[model samples]
Target: MPMDRRSVLKGASGIAAASTLSGCLGFLGGGGGGGNQGDAMLWHAMTESETETFEESLSIYNDENDAEIVAEENGDLRNNVETTLPTGDGPEMYRWAQDWAGNHYQRDFLYDASDDIDFNLEDTFSQAAVQAITVGADDAVVGLPVGGETVTLLYNKDMVDSPPETYAEMESTMEEYHDPSNGQYGLSHPIDAYFVSAWMHAFGGYYFQVNEDGEGVTGLDLDETKRGMEFVRDSIWPYVPADTNPGPQQAIFQNGSAPFAVNGPWSIATFEDNGINVGVTSFPTVDGNTPSPYTGTSMWYFTTRMADDEDRRESALDYAKWISQSEERQRAYADAHSDVPVLNSISAEDLGDQVAGFKGSYEGGIAMPNHPKMGSVWTPTEDAMNAVLQDDADIDSRFDEAAETVRSNWEE
Candidate 1:
C-alpha cells in the first residue's frame, strides 16, 4: 500500500526487475517513444521464463487483433507509470501490483475498464483478486488480474521424502540435513520482513491494525509480534547461514547444497532447468496452523493516457481481454511459469501439481495491504528482524522500539 518502492525493497523483484530491465531494454536510453499510432506498448517486470511465456501469449492477441502488442521490460514500472502516465507516455498498459491499483486510481492515473472489457467480473476472478483491483464504492476495475505469487516451501525431493508439517519436524529435519562445512543449510531465506511475515502471522502477529473499512491501517501489534520474533531468534536463525542475503541463499539452493528453501514460483523454472527434483508445499505450521505468507497479485492496468487515443485504448483492452478472459492463454501462461492463475475459471487441477502446491500454500495467506500506511511498517520491522537475529540481541526492547517507530511513522 505504500506509494514507493522502499517498503517492498526486499521482495519487490518484479518491480525491481522492471527498473533494471528498463535500462537493459534501452527505455532508460530514451530510444522508445510513448505509445503511438501503430504499437500498443506494454511494460512488465516478469522473470525470464514468465516473460517468455507472456510474450508467446501476446502473439495470440497480436495475430488475432492485427495489432502489434509490444511488451518491453521496465525495471522501475511503478515509478515510471507514476511519472509518465500523466504526461501521456508510451505503455498503454503495464503489469503492476493489485494492491497498488487503488493508489493509482486515486491519482487518476488508471482507466476504469469496468465496461470496456467484456466479461463477468464476478464469474471470472477470485473475490480477492477482484477486490484488490477494484476501487471506491462503484468498484471500478483499475487493474486486470493475471496471476499471483506466494512464498512457499520448495524442498529438494531427493533430499526430503516429505514436507514437514510442524516446526519441530522442520527443526529435526534441518538438524539432519544442515551441514554448513560443505555449503549446506537446513533453511534458506533472507530474514527480512517480507519473508518473516509468514512466521509472524502464524504466531497471531500482524504488522498493522486494519480499520473497520479495511481500506486504512492503524498502529502496530507489538506483543504478538514479539512472540514471533522470539521464535525467529531462538529457532530459525541457527539453521540458516549467518550471511543469508537472498542472492547467496538462492545460490546455495541452486547448487543443491541446501535441500529446502522458501521462495515463490519464479524459482521453479530455475531449479527444474538445473535438473533438481523440486517439491513444493505450504509454509510449515507453527502451533497447529499454517503461517500466512503475503500474497502478491500481478495485474495489468489500462492507463488514462490511452483513453484519449481510442485506437490504442481499444487494442490495449483487447490484449487484456485476450490474456485474462481466454482460458487457453491463461492456462498456457500459468502452465509455462508454474504460477497460480488469478482466474477462478482456471482450476487447480489444470495448473499441474507444482503450481497447485503453491495455490494450496496461499490459501492461508493474506493479500499484502495496498494502503499507503503499509509503507510505515516495513523499514522498522525489517530493522527489528535484523537486530533480533544478532547474538547480543534484546528481543522485547528491540521490538518495542520498532513498534514505537511504526506508531511514530503513522502519527507523522
Candidate 2:
C-alpha cells in the first residue's frame, strides 16, 4: 500500500520504438523453444483491439532493440501457463493479474526478475505497482507492471451536476433519484465480493495480512466487516434492485434507469459507446473513511523455463523493461485501452480528469491478497451477502457465519 487515498490519484505513463517484428507469434499456438538469438514468445489473454495494442507496443520494443518478439493471444492462457511452466515448455513471458503472482511463485514456476530488469522501481512506477510485483521475504521482483485498474463511482453527468463527495450525500442522491416504480435508481452495483470490497475498506476492514516472511495471516476484521455488511444490508439494499450482477447493473446505468454505479474502467468504453455521459471519481467517503476498492494490475511474468535459457531470459527481460520503463509507450497504452498506467514518469497532466480519479481510487485502494487462501474468500462472502439481501438471517449473524466459512476453507 502507498500513501492513503489522497496521494495516489495524483499521477503515472511508457515508449514504443518505431520498428516491427519479422514474424508473428502464433496465436494460441503451442509454445516454442527458447530464442536462439533475440527472438522470444509472449503469451497473453488480451482480445481483439487489445491484442492489437499489445502487438504494437511489442513491435516498438522489437524495433528499438533488434529483438524478434512473437506475441500471441491464448483463450486458455491461465490453464496453459499453470500446466506447462513446470515442464519447462511455457512461453518466455505471460500476462497475468498481480494477485496471481503469489500462487504461481509458490508453485516454483515463476522467475525472479529482480536482477534482470533495468529500471529502478521507486523512480519509475507507483509504490502500489512496485509492491504488486514484489514477492517473498526478500521482496524479489516477480513481474513487470503494466496496466492497472480499480473500481470507482461512475455516475451520469446528465442526471447530476457533480459526483457525490461522501456516502451520506450519495444516500441523499439515492433518496431523490431511486424510483423503482419508474425503473430508475440512484445507484446500482454488482452484489459480489469483488464489488463489496470497496465497502469493506471504507469501514476499515481487510481480508488478510502478510508478514515479513511473505506468509499470509487471515485477518478478516470481523467487527468492522460486519459493520460494512450491515450498511449494505440495511442501507444500500433498499435503493438497489432485488438482484443485480455486472451485466444488469451496467445495463441499468447505461440505459439511464440508474444514475450512478460502481464499476471498473473496463466498462467505460461500453458506457461511452451507448452514449452515456459518464463521469468517474473515487468512491465517496463512508463513515468519514475513504472507500478503498480492490486494486488490480496486469503484469508481465518471466517464467522459470525462460530463465533456464540465458539468451531467452536476457531477451525477455530486455523487452519487459522496455515495455514497462518506456514512458511514451505507457502513454500510448493508456490512450489505446482507456487504462491507467502504473509508471510515475508519465505525469498527471497527461491522464486528464476522469482517469486521474480512477488513479486516485487505486491510490486509496487495497491490493487484493495474492495468497492462495484468497481463493476461499469470494464464495463465502458472496453467499453471506446474498443471504442478507434475501432476508435469510440477521446481518450480524450472517456475517459471523460467513467469517466462519472463510476460516474453514482456509483451514482445509
Candidate 3:
C-alpha cells in the first residue's frame, strides 16, 4: 500500500493520546536526573482526557515505584520533541513513528529496553508489531508499539439494515439499501491517495510486484487491479449519488446521510457518540480471498538527546516496552479507547462479545508500506481513484492509473 497517512491514520485519537500519556508518565527532564532520585519531567502532546488518564495511571505507578515522573500536556509536544533532542531538552519519554524511531536511533535519542522492561515478549503482542518496532537495519532497539488502527469494513447499519452474509448478497443488497433518489450514496471514501491504496489492496492487487523468484521487487500491478476498481467506481460510487457524496466522509456518516461508508476505527467514537449502529468486518472478499486492511504501526521511540548514561536509557526503554508489550496495558487501552488490543493474551478470546464480531477483521490486517517514499504516494493515487469514483474515468483503466501512481511514488 502507498504511504499516505489516512489509510494508516484511521483511529486518530487513541495512539496520539496513549503516547502522550506514556511519554509524560515516564518523562524525566531538567538535568535528566532527579533530586536524590532526580525528577523526571515529561512533555507530551495528548488530548486533555488522555492526559488525565495517564495521570491516573501514574498515580498507580507512584504508589509502587520510587521514581517520581512529572508530566504536562504540551500542545506542540510532538514538534517540540525534536527541538529538545538536539539541545537535549526533549522528554525522557515520548512516542513517535517507526521512521522517526530509526532516525533518532542514529542520533542516539533513545535507550535499550531488552533487560529492564517488565513485559515478556514470547507471551505478549503480535510478532509483526514487535519486530517492526525493535529491529532495524542495524538491529538497534528503536521503539515500541503503543497502539495501532487497522483498516476494516465500516458500513452504516441504517443503510444495510441487515449485514450481508456473503459478497454477492452484499452487492445485491446494495441496490435495495442505496437510495440515490433520497440523495444518499451506497458508500463514500475520499478520492485521494490515502484512500485509494486500500481500495486497491481490497482487490488483491499490491504495489510491489513480485519477481518470478518470489522476492519482493518493484513492478506495478495496475494491469491486474481493474475488477476491484470497476466494482467501486461503476458499482458503488454511482449509487452514492452526485453532490450527495458530501465533503469528508466522517461528516457523511455522522449525519447518517451516507447509508454506507468505509473508514477506520478512529471514527468508532463518533459513530457510537452519534448513536449510529455501526457494523465493522473484514475489509471485504475478492478473488476468493478475504481482503486485509492496511495495518500501520505506531511506536515509542528513544532519541539520541537523552543522557548517555546506560542505566537511565535502559529505564526509558523499559518504560516504552512496558506499554508496548503488555497485555494488561493493551486491555486498559481498549477499555479507555475503543481499540482491539494487540497482544496474545488479549486475543479474540479476550475481547468479549462487543468486539467478538469484529475480531476476525483484525486478523486480516496488512502492514502498510515501511518505505521512506510511502508518505509521498497518497496524493496522486487518490486522484486516480477519484477519477473512477467521480465517473470521470473508466474503472478498469483508473485503477491501473492508480497503480502506476503508486509505482512512480514508491521508494522501493
Model 3, 198-245: lDDT tens digits are: 555566665543344533333233544565555556555555545322
Which ten contiguous residues of candidate 3 have the minimum total lDDT? 20-29
Look at candidate 3 and tell me the lDDT of residue 24.
16
Query: After superposition, which runs of candidate 3 have C-alpha atoms over 4 Å from their true positions?
Result: 1-43, 97-123, 156-162, 196-198, 208-222, 225-228, 241-248, 352-359, 394-412
- Per-residue CA lDDT of candidate 2, range 96-183, in tens? 6676777788788788877766657888888778878887777778888886777788898888788889988988888898998988
Candidate 1 vs. true structure, TM-score: 0.85
Poorest 10 consecutive residues by lDDT, candidate 1: 21-30
Lowest lDDT 10-mer window, candidate 2? 9-18
Candidate 1 residues lying further than 4 Å off, grouped into runs, are 1-32, 67-70, 115-120, 136-138, 181-183, 309-312
Question: How do all models score by TM-score?
Answer: 0.85, 0.88, 0.76
| Local distance difference test values of all predictions, in order | 0.70, 0.70, 0.52
C-alpha RMSD of each candidate structure in angstroms:
4.1, 7.2, 5.9
* Ranking 1 against 3 by lDDT, winner: 1
